[model samples]
Target: MKVLYNHEYPRRVRLAAIGCGGHAIRNVFSTHPYAPIDLVAVCDLDRERAEHTGCMFGAKAAYTDYHEMLEREKPEAVTVVTNYDEDGRPRYPQIAIDCMQAGAHVWIEKPPAASSAEVLDMMRVSEATGKFVAVGFKKMFFPANVKAREIITRPAFGSISTITARYPEALPPLEDRQDLHKMWRFLDHIVHPWSVLQYLAGPAESIFVQRSPTGGTVTAIQFASGAVGSLHLDRGQGSSSFLERTEIVGPGGNVVIHNNTKLTFYSDGPKPAGGYGRSGDYYGGDERAALHWEPEFSLGQLYNKGIFLLGYAPEIRYFCQCVLDDTPPEVGTLDNALEMLRIYEAYCQPDGQHIRIDTEPGKVS
Candidate 1:
């Protein structure tokens, strides 16, 4: 629990970065100051972007070739924030495997790979090299999601029975499922909610989908924990609508997260002394009342920033901490990514198709 200031951590993890795109610039680079990492070099295929980002982020070196940068800088870890290939497959799986082989742990961006098979390949490399790899599944680290997890795991919350999550994205028509480019948006975005669901509910056992003409999808999921869940992919919603909502139900209690910011938890409580008809006020005592949390915007605190509030900084911090602690990441690991990919595969198939998710070899039911 030692908080390392950026200037004071003289022995922080030596790190290199391999992208200078918009996400890298806005979220990834800005997060290193809050992590136990000293970025030593920045790399991108575009040399100009590499140098500019290096200068902006206080990296001492820049390179157009990541292989050369990995060899020369020898960072303890590297962040791969690059994008997809021409064929719409992510570039990070190969880059991560190479980084691990080069003796550096790796943190890669979401949609870890095009498929579960690719994620499994990266998992194999991680095992062989003994270097940990993690994907930035930021939603699982969001304050609201974190709080929901805390609430549901409490002994008083009873056994979790159901979950419902909503996210804004469109799954392409069935005809386009085979086209990687056509399905690119779905692949890139589905990981956000899938990560959150698996984080709270564990691995899913079976899945079925129902799609609408407007390109939205509602997936019915059955988790291994005997939990039933629904994922609503909200496409064509108004541009001004705030984006996500989630609710989880246990025995006599429930937790809800709205727009990824507000969290409200309702606990099991006795009825008002008389009855619903006799109660004069709606207020329940503190012990039985709902608990609510949302940030106040008046303070200029670090926690008020979107990077921190929405989870980018915390996710990066978690990755760096695991590297410093010499432990495999407990969350956001390759195994987690593999489970998410199985969910993604379920979506690629038509409704009513029975898809059994395989969490381990010979483990599917």
Candidate 2:
């Protein structure tokens, strides 16, 4: 298979899109024109919204019910970007299962399911139907995060000793977790950081957490790789402030991502010439010095678009390409979804108590 690049002859993948909501309108649907997909149909519970999105994206048909759309269109694949219910439950697993059973591949949005049980069901359906299902874990699709994954996996970086992820979200207190309404906000948002952790480090072995009175939650995680990690939910940060910051520490180097866009790598360094009080300069011509990357917004290029810069376009293209080649997706597989759900469930229990996640190889906790 050809490696996908920014500009290339597009390989066509027939597709049906589901959900005509704000997220699909702004991110998923907008990215199809740039990917290797032909939007053949659109489906939504609201007929008017479905027709509007279908017409806007040049789809041939629109339907209020996804089952009708799948039966009529018989698309090679389907994209799902629906919103969560008031109870924080995801509605995509059943739809995805139906699409897969209808002989179409599926690309469902993040928070693949409300719980790990749902993900297991989707996996069983996919296996039985011989169709692949790729969850839209968009954070792992970002260029910076991709590069960070590559960096952390290198031999020179050694085994990752620690990781810290910061995102502006809040988890309800333990007492409120049983209420689906109270947990809904967290269920919708925690997938972002959870995906990153699973991508770079691997499955979390165990987790201990603390919930703040102000709605924020803090977690300490131990990965199967024996690396420690911290997840800080910042409920009170100003929206104007950088939304995220992540750091991964290895033997003699570390990588830091600022605001989800800028990435800097700090490698082994030489000692300063003078004493601690009289250091000469931050940079001293060391060969193994730091490296950094951030996009320049001046150019009116494809990179300037949020869909491209933030990984939405790349992720869509990846799914389409996998479908065209009859291959499974690497980033958003059922196994990854299972790991993410494990972390989500860890927060449901009270703080300072460890939760064990069952895995194929062994027990995680």
Model 1 lDDT per residue over 186-302, tens place: 999999989999999988899888888989888899999999999999888899998999999999699999999999999888756667688876766767898899998999777
> How does each model score on lDDT?
0.88, 0.85
Q: Native-vs-model 2 lDDT?
A: 0.85
Per-candidate TM-scores read: 0.96, 0.93
Model 2 C-alpha lDDT per residue in residues 95-137, reported as the tens digit of each score = 8899999999999998788888888888888878889999988
| Candidate 2: Cα lDDT at 290 | 86
TM-score of 1: 0.96
Model 1: lowest-lDDT 10 consecutive positions: 356-365
lDDT of 2 at 238: 82
